[model samples]
Target chain A: EAGVAQSPRYKIIEKRQSVAFWCNPISGHATLYWYQQILGQGPKLLIQFQNNGVVDDSQLPKDRFSAERLKGVDSTLKIQPAKLEDSAVYLCASSLGSPLYGYTFGSGTRLTVV
Target chain B: GQQVMQIPQYQHVQEGEDFTTYCNSSTTLSNIQWYKQRPGGHPVFLIQLVKSGEVKKQKRLTFQFGEAKKNSSLHITATQTTDVGTYFCAGLKTGANNLFFGTGTRLTVIP
Candidate 1:
């Protein structure tokens, strides 16, 4: 089986500029998650989707960050007016919807805000 | 808000040495999962422990969940250069679907 796929392995944007990262989870996976990992830190959950419907977004910066998993297959995370603090690796993961089953993560998109 | 924390943010060891990382949560967890993220790569799931006092082993790695479900540990026997990476433990709260990840422990193995 193929692993989760992400595009634009790297991105650089100026402060206040906008950027978007795309992800395609494994086939047949109904639960998708977006995480942000800063250098030397663990990945933080940004948002979660269960088959196109949001299951959680409590940690997402609503004023700047937004994500959507359309058709319950692929997901896109957008950062509007990117800030220096937003420079981090964005990871996407998918699971079988049961905690018993672990998640499969993508290679991630490394974003740099200047 | 829930948080998980890991001790010894970084560790260095020679090949064939033993290494261990610990994870703790403020509150009890329903389940805990461990992951390894190689340098320049994404996190890969290593194992999951759900029951209290549960211990699982894979190859030279052993994972343990506390009886109180608020602490966990990962022990590696005879570490190898390939074991160099960041180890993270994520805990899920009761009735919650989201996971809270701990500050990872970065391991460097010198061969």
Candidate 2:
């Protein structure tokens, strides 16, 4: 089976600019997650989707960060008016509904906010 | 709010020495998953523990889940240079559907 796929391996944008990263989870996965990892920190969950419905977004900064998993297959995370502190690696991962099956993560998009 | 923390933010060991990293969660966890992220790479799943006081091993590495299910540990014996990377523990809170990730422990094995 193919691993989760992410696009635009790297991105650079100025502060207050908008940027988006795309992700295609592993085929047949019913749960998708978006995580943001700072240079020296652990990956923080931004949003999660169970099929087409959202399961979690409590940590997402709604004002600046938004994510959607349409059709329950692919997802896109957008940061509007990106802040300097928002510069980090955006990772996407997917797994079966049960926690028994571990997640498969993508390469991730390294975003740099100047 | 849920939080998972790992101790020894960073550690350096000789190629043939032993190393260990610990993960603790604020709430009881139903299951725990471990991942390793090499420099310049994304995290890759290493193993998962679902039972209380469970102990699993792969090659020279050992994983243990506390009896309380709120803590876990990963031990590497005779560490090799190839074991260099950050280890993370993600815990699934009881009755919850999402995972709470740990701070991660970065290990450097000197050859």
Candidate 3:
């Protein structure tokens, strides 16, 4: 079975610019998530969607970051007016559901905001 | 807000040596999942533990969940060059909807 897929493996942009990343989850998976990982740190959840509905996004910088999973299959995460601190890897992951099940991750998009 | 912390931010060992990483959660978890991410690669799921005190093994890797459901450990016996990567432990707190990932433990095995 194919794993989660992400686009534009690497990206570089100037601060204050906008950047977007796309994700295609595993077939039939019901949950999708976006996470940010700074160098040498674990992934920090940015948002989670279950069947097109947001499940959680408490850690997301709502003022600049937004995500959507329209129709529950593919997802997109966007950062507008990106800041220098947003120069981390953006990982997209999918799961069957809940913690009892493991998640499959996509090769993240490494964003560098100058 | 919850925090899951992993011990020994980094570990370097001989190819034949053993290594272990620990994870401690601020709150009880319903289940915990472990993943391994090789350099420049995405995280690959390793295992998940649900029952308190549960122990699971995969080849040379052994995973343990604490009796209190707030801690976990991953032990790799006779580490090999192929085992070099960052190991992460993520958990779903009893009432949370998303999994909280711990600071990863980066492993380097000298061949």
TM-score of each: 0.98, 0.98, 0.98
Tens-digit lDDT track of model 3 for B1-111 = 688999999999999999999999999999999999999888889998999899999999999999999999999999999999999999988888878899999999999
Write candidate 3's Cα lDDT for A1-114 as tens digits. Answer: 998999989999999999999999999989999999999999999999998999999889999999999899999999999999999999999989864678889999999999
The lDDT values for all models are: 0.94, 0.93, 0.93
User: By DockQ, who's the top model here?
Assistant: 3
lDDT of 1 at A19: 97
Among residues 3 or more apart in sequence or in different chains, the pairs in candidate 1 whose N, CA or C atoms overlap within 3 Å are none
Model 2, residue B46: C-alpha shift (Å): 0.7
lDDT of 2 by residue, B14-89 (tens): 9999999999999999999999999999999999999999999999999999999999999999999999999999
Q: Write the per-residue lDDT of candidate 1 for residues A4-48, one digit (tens) a residue.
A: 999899999999999999999999989999999999899999999
Docking class of 1: high
Which one wins by DockQ: 1 or 3? 3
